[model samples]
Target: MGTVDRRSFLAWLSTGAVAAATLGRGGSLAVAEAERGATAGEVLVLRGATVFDGTGTGATADTTVVCASGRIVAVGRGLPGGLPAGARVVDCSGAFVIPGLWDAHTHSTEITPTVPALHLVHGVTGVREMRGSPATHEVRRRIERGTLAGPRMVVASNTLDGPDSRVPGATLIETDDDAREAANAARQEGADLLKVYSFLPRDQHTAIARHADRVGLPFAGHSPSLLPVHEVIRRGQRSVEHNYGMHLSTSVDAEDYFARLAALPDEPTDPNWWGRLAPLWEREAFRTYDRGRAGALAGLFAEHGAWHVPTLAVESAYARHPTRFLDDDQAQERARRWLPASLREQWRARVQAWPEWSPERAETELAYLDARLRLVADLAEDGAPVAAGTDCGSPYVFPGVAVHDELALLVRAGLSPARALRAATRDAARCAGIADAGTVVAGAHADLVVLDADPLADIGNSRAIRAVVTRGAYLGPTERQRLFDEIERAADGSEAPQPAGPAPASCCGPPPE
Candidate 1:
């Protein structure tokens, strides 16, 4: 139960001491030999790693985990008898194992096959696709049926918006009947949840909420701009994505802000009118933030069991700290290399279109960013549930890799490394309503990340992925590297990207400000 030094542990494993001890007794060596000739679906035994079970608990050192049939069969210091016959054994000494990560808010269906593989390569085992359609459903099906090697998906219905919706192809709800019909259609389409957008009418949103409850589907997305945060939570929105509406709701001038927002033209002259005005309002909110109000809001979230997926990575890309990632030449180049040609072009044009801010405006934006980070910290302090999300498939929010950025930002916002990891693992699964995932316990899905360094020591160490075990199959360094190479080649346009059917409606309009 003592902390093991990484160097010493690796040295011990390198000398084959741990391996010998693991296989020296109980005929484990014979089992290992049998595993070499076994086909896929063989049991996977991971030995000698420190395990963080994703329950906000202390790491357990020198643990062994057994996986079979896509479920964790056992987790202990050592097997009572021996390793299973025909089980593939991975020596994980010096490594740290945690439940596979999840990006709880993603528009993955917008950029299909590559997005999924990219997620897997970065140790993401599950994703909540925010905008779902037949294409997303098909992607989920392919992943489930083994035709695609990708993360498990929890798909949401196509975005339901109101008249003059910003998102392309959104299902417009103008009446209670429209809401009910949309809900029923989402269920019929096999969506795991209903996705509501910003522009929904209050009555329609209420109707949708009722219909979602009737259809046994949880509804989550941007808090309708017309509703107050407390009302949204009370109305049973399962999770709020991107912290939309939080700035206004937590401001001391909340009532005034709400009234002004409500007074906006029902049909604005410009489709992105809100986007253009959001920064000014957000700055005002930050300047007038009231901790008491923010604390009360966080308390309401906890009281109602509502969750927050901040998607801080995308928020920073668009507003808080755009230059940090968007303006970094190296970062842009790296991201572009992973994006398809069309998307790369689109991102370039979008970035080019951003306005040049004055010094005062830049300072205010940074202050707003600080205010948002403070709100996140307060939410955590108040015991409000927070989950990690990248809002990937949006401009500058690269799938897979953005999860790490989100984690780092979460830590920067005052979560401990363990807490941030839990946001991406345990809390993420809970938010997505996935019962048997985001943990390393018996009966949980056998999805795990093995890291070369302790993530608890530093959240950034999460990117030091040594291997990924998903659905009882291991993707060690070589396999993961191959996946990365394939994606890179596809991004390079050397090979045709495998189509993942029709793309879901683009939900990246105007960056949601």
Candidate 2:
């Protein structure tokens, strides 16, 4: 069988059983109810809300949704005549009901009490954590046990990198045997997926991919610098994280570009290596971007069912417009109240330490981002799935709030507001292979958000959250405010400062010049 022993294998099954048991009681009953069907005695009716339903369709105004056992049992202009006894009814007139959002490229190793609280307040009901350490595993266990308030997490094992890997706590694979063992270990650790990183040797990466397939663990994350974009997709990388290697693939001279990268030291000794190499990579990508080749690549992505999590918010924060939030009064306020002081200071330090970016170079970076945005739109238009993610936990990328900003960026890049919503909802669920989430329909999870304004009118309206529902547990405006207050308290320095967790690695190459 698998490399894991019988005892551990049985324990894994027990964990699965625990998950199933937890899904059936109290606030989690909706999950169990959805499967068997909600009866009249246990129904909750939301009346007269405009429902977008996360189907990438136009909204239906003045509609009612009947939820029972955590599933949307019915959606129509009005509810059935006489509801069941003890049925709960909520007046949702003037509100907009949509599927709960997902941040598909989160890093949960950064969890503090403040992190999950912020995410729930923002109505991000789910996340796909890109890397998982023992700390993250414990956090997930607590969330599952209902001891913590957080998004549903689908976790990848601690990232797998090669000898020259830069991420702290990463598992290094340098040989074929190492690849197999690592994949097996991740699966045994109960990871939902394997996060492959940059810097892996080609043969080692291939070995990992093969072993991952054999172990039934899907792999996603960085496109190793050693491999071409097409090769990564063809080899069954379920999704590409960020906009690095794929963006590089737009170049007609992509091979020459990679050859130049390969010639550099595997582990650059200079702290300024990022500052030195970033401008050149950007310049080459801009110079040789070929629309025909890009379209061909999009076709391949569609054929292979390879998804993309373009964490445009984090990229924009550091590259195209590093100074955008530097002086914003609201950002400053949030930084003080909601973000840990150490993390906030780290962000400011990184910014202050960077050399000046000239206006000309800044404009070039903006132009390159614009080009990549166009490519994103084109790929989705050609039926390649695109998911919205903020690369949360990265410097200056706030956990919950950045997803809303990412949606706005997606719209600005050419997606309609509905299309952008789909990226964070339906498309993100697809990316994670989560069948029960990302929609407001029969048999779906009951996670949802009630917005004060219609997001279809403008994605920015998504921030007008009136309430949030997670697994059928409702968080009204009062409750939501309490969550924010709790976060503020938790983040304040009144408590002892937590030791900084290892910084997440940048799969996206150096910041733009």
What stretches of model 1 exceed 4 Å from their correct place?
1-41, 270-279, 320-327, 492-513
**What is the RMSD, in Å, between candidate 1 and the native fold over all Cα?**
7.5
- For model 2, where is the 10-residue window of minimal lDDT? 23-32
Which regions of candidate 2 fall more than 4 Å away from where they truly are?
A: 1-35, 38-42, 262-267, 270-279, 320-326, 493-509
What's the TM-score of every candidate structure? Answer: 0.86, 0.86
219-310: candidate 1 lDDT, tens digit per residue: 99988777778889999999998766788888888888778766776754665455335435756777788888888988898998899998
lDDT of 2: 0.74
User: All models: lDDT?
Assistant: 0.77, 0.74
For model 2, residues 1-513, the per-residue Cα lDDT tens digits are 013233432232233222343332122112233323423224566778888888766787886665655556555564544344555678999999999999999864345777776788899998988877666777778877888878888888888988777666678899888888888999888899999986676787899889999999999988887677788999999998777676677788877776776566555465434323533575558667887878888888889988988898877776645455678777778888987777787767755555566788777777777776887887777777899888887666888999998999899889999999989998898888798889876567778899999899988999999988887667888989888888888785532233324443344424423
